[model samples]
Target: MFRDTSHLVVEELSRTLERIDPAQVQAFVDALLAADKVFVVGVGRVLLALQAMTKRFAHLGIAITYVGAITEPAITPKDLLVVGSGSGSSLFPLAIARKAKAIGAKVVHIGSNPQSDMKDVADFMVRIPVRTKLYLDDEIDSRQPMTSLFEQSLLIFGDIVAKMIIDERQLDLKGLWQHHANLE
Candidate 1:
């Protein structure tokens, strides 16, 4: 039973991976690289993934802020907001995205729904092909519990994007370490 569970999970993930659009990922990377400031927002485990990306962005010398952090200043036109929403219909993220747009900040949405509400306001979006709540009845149902596949994929995607940034900027371990907080 355990082995079967493992195989099922792997199969689901592999399918999800094959469905990702590299062009969309590259566009996301391009926006992040061009932005003066980047803010990330997500809910639940998705938020955790965004936070992880935020840490790596800081280490990579990119100006980044977590959406609700006290240290996060006003998001302006020069900034960018990267949102990770599995449902894409979450009220909070939608409201924030709207506000960001009103302030002239560009939005990049990463989610499982290409038709998600947030996608409407997004200047750029990447739709991760996964079994999210938005499409639970789809043929490719998740073997794991609700939204786990999407959340896990989001985390992996964050790592992948970080590596891409590191490579694109020619960043090395030594340079990354320099940005690590030494005061702690």
Candidate 2:
């Protein structure tokens, strides 16, 4: 009767977060805040993570968009593209990161592979290793089942960074609520 695997997963996440280098995280945050604009991308559930980030930045009056958004293609060389590629093995994100670099855009990859091709082309990288219960289903999302440990991490990590930014700026609930969805 004592059996669901919450503690194990939480412990794993704590270790994963602990592995993140604080200095690098700060530098990354500073670089992101300095960007002229921010665009984020990820395939599948990862895209949801990017959307979470978009909402937070929207509250701060900063420009942020997901690659799938109507305005994303307009992101230019002066902008920053944050790709949430947890595997760093994705061909599409790697290609985009390379293309983004060629055009003078700044690329930030949040993933587990620091030595991956995407990282080689990225201006910044924050690696968060994830162990999925399965693999191929994550790409095509088949019936074998899927889970979004990486996606969850991206959302959680993005919120962490957003909270840090909000605190640093002394922003209050009133400030954040100004950006909340009134239509909802």
On lDDT, the leading prediction is 1
Tens-place lDDT per residue, model 2, 97-143, is 77777888898888766666786788878867555433433222212
The candidate maximizing TM-score is: 1
Model 1: CA > 4 A from native = 1-4, 136-139
Residue clash pairs of candidate 2: none
What is the overall TM-score of model 1 with all chains considered together? 0.92
Candidate 1 residue-wise lDDT, 1-55, digit = tens: 9999989988887888778889999999999999999999988889998898888
Whole-model lDDT values for every prediction: 0.86, 0.73
| TM-scores of the models, in the order given | 0.92, 0.85
lDDT computed for candidate 2: 0.73
For candidate 1, which ten residues in a row score worst on lDDT? 134-143
Candidate 1 local Cα displacement, residue 42, angstroms: 1.2
lDDT at 140 for candidate 2? 23
